[model samples]
Target: MAYCYTASIFFPSSSSSSSILANDRLPHLAYRPAKIKRRLSFSCAALPFDLSPPPIDHDLLDTMTVAGAKVSEDGVIGTFDNDDEALDAVENGVAVVDLSHYGRIRVSGEDRVQFLHNQSTANFEILHEGQGCDTVFVTPTARTIDIAHAWIMKTAITLVVSPVTRERIIDMLKKYIFFADKVEIQDITQQTSLFVLIGPKSDQIMEALGLADIVEQPYGSHKHYSVNGMPITVGVGNLISEEGYSLLMSPAAAESVWKVLLGHGAIPMGSNAWETLRILQGRPAPDKELTDEYNVLEANLWNAVSLNKGCYKGQETISRLVTYDGIKQRLWGIRVSSPVEPGSTISVNGKKVGKVTSFTTGKRASQPLGLGYIKRKAASEGDSVIIGDDVEGTVVEVPFLARQIPPS
Candidate 1:
């Protein structure tokens, strides 16, 4: 097994032989200096406008009841009586959420399709109107730069990546466009708006907004429709257990749209609430649970990787890794009693096997749960491990239960 070092660095090209070393007295894992420029800080102002007051020292929210717990810190928002109830809220009830932490980029120009096809893991050229896909952009050496979801719009290509990879993705794209045709990259994270709706009742909210005749489709399916007689675009994603849909609109239309949904009975959930939902479902978010160091297979990103799709960057490594069973680690979920923190080591039989990436507590006083990367041999559900120093945790199967998706 590779030894843990302190420095965090990007492995740009497969052939490049530079290795990072860390000398700090912290965790003994290898570290590579993060490449992002710290131009924006959490203390800095939120772009466009700041809706809430300045963040308090303890900004975490709690949603608990007398019978059960809400969500815990580290971003778990609410607590439902059971898994089915939580899924029901997503499928049939309104689940208003704030995904502002997600990074957004805009690609425009005649060559946008070709440009993205060359840079992303998925076949961008195959994407038609109203459809979007999950893809990863990696360095020549196959280290991940960003995991992004891309959509084709009338005038531009919109990409949503993690905050950590936003700048690196932009820079990488720029370097690749050296001899390419017309293409412009712009950060439009704040200029545009995004929201998610999942459930049988979701249609009611869309219909309330005047989004008529919206045809139902499966995950990875999408189409253009009008809401409230206003032109809006929709994308289908991550609906393994319900009718799921993601909504995109101009910033100007966001407030009005939010009000309409609330009036239609949608529950305005914070970021933590949505994240807990995602984690419980085995979904991986950029940087938080996935990064450049992981291959698509290791990250359980099969939904996004199309085997039949033609060649793209890093396809060779993916194919080789899959064919040879070369995946070294797997991202899986675990339930722990102790508070788990990201970057902590996960051990089995007293040997280092994996590391924790994301962890959260119960809404009020429930047990702690976390998502971590583990050696494939150590990944079975019900397996046990220790987190941080003394926190005890157990591995659990994803989705935490059976998932049901709506009809196409």
Candidate 2:
């Protein structure tokens, strides 16, 4: 009989899994609404699969319509709204979208820090109280195991990675545990909930809920706080003009937090809006674009890596790629004349050169754009590439949106 699991935390038998040595480590880790709150009906009784897929219960489509967001399911559609309500919700107020499908993993034990630092692409030792980082976990050969946001609570490190790569992340991390001391890995994805607070006014929203005091810090930094009196682990970062804070807490707290945001005038956005924002910002997500073959450098994750840090697993390869300028391809955003699917191939002069990773109808710019991995030398803003007949795209900068100052 075949067994299946929704996440990548399961331990394989000794004979089935390879005991690989890890060189180093790294880290990291949304919401919804009502009125539009309808009980979704998805039938699984007659389906061939025995396992039940998690249902989409947020009344996502209605929520988007009521909020006046342009809604499309093809991954490129945005809701049609006057006053740019989607953008407004992300600017002046807060928004919650379903992010449960994203992957998450936890690392614990006395050696967790040492193990992660050696295997990850960032400097874990510099992680202090109220700090987080964007980083990558790599295999011994320098392939990316997972791109993650790492947060440290005391000595415990939590990595919120892409679900598509969750298994490899677990397998890869476990491979390096031979003879390591006291490190227990757990997959707490189902037990915990993820809620994101994004907008220029995000701080105010947090303040209203008593999450934190206003302060100056980089995008990947955060502090512990409470929401509606519920304790939560918080991590913050800049996603375009909107500063983002992710709440790691219980499901009950998750619902209460969403209610509080709605009461505070936050526009509840659907997953569609979130996807559009992510693509427009050039953030690489798993399955949609991020994969094993893509390295951190090519994925535009430079801000996440710390060169001054000591050796970790795959450091030699990463160092060489960073200094030697030997990476052949790099990920870039492009303005395309036509819509392309996520996995569509990109070409130049009739030769295959790259592949499209994510595409979106820019709700703000009123144009279609895509994220793709192209040959490094050929990947430049304003450079034109062809996808199909009469379908051409021009390379553009990573982040199409500008940042805004927090309220004083």
Best-fitting candidate, scored by lDDT: 2
lDDT, candidate 2, equals: 0.61
Give all TM-scores, in the order shown: 0.70, 0.73
Report the C-alpha lDDT of model 2 over 89-194, residue by residue, as the tens digit: 7756666554544566788888887888887878888776456776777666566666677777564777878767777788878878878467877776665567
User: Scored by CA lDDT, what does every candidate get?
Assistant: 0.58, 0.61
- How big is the positional error of residue 105 in model 2, measured in Å on the Cα after superposition? 2.4
- True-vs-predicted CA distance for residue 180, candidate 1, Å: 4.1
lDDT tens string, model 1, 1-75?
232212111111212222111121111112232222111111211111222232322122321223244544433
Q: Whose TM-score is greatest here?
A: 2
TM-score of 2: 0.73
Candidate 2 clash figure, as a count: 30
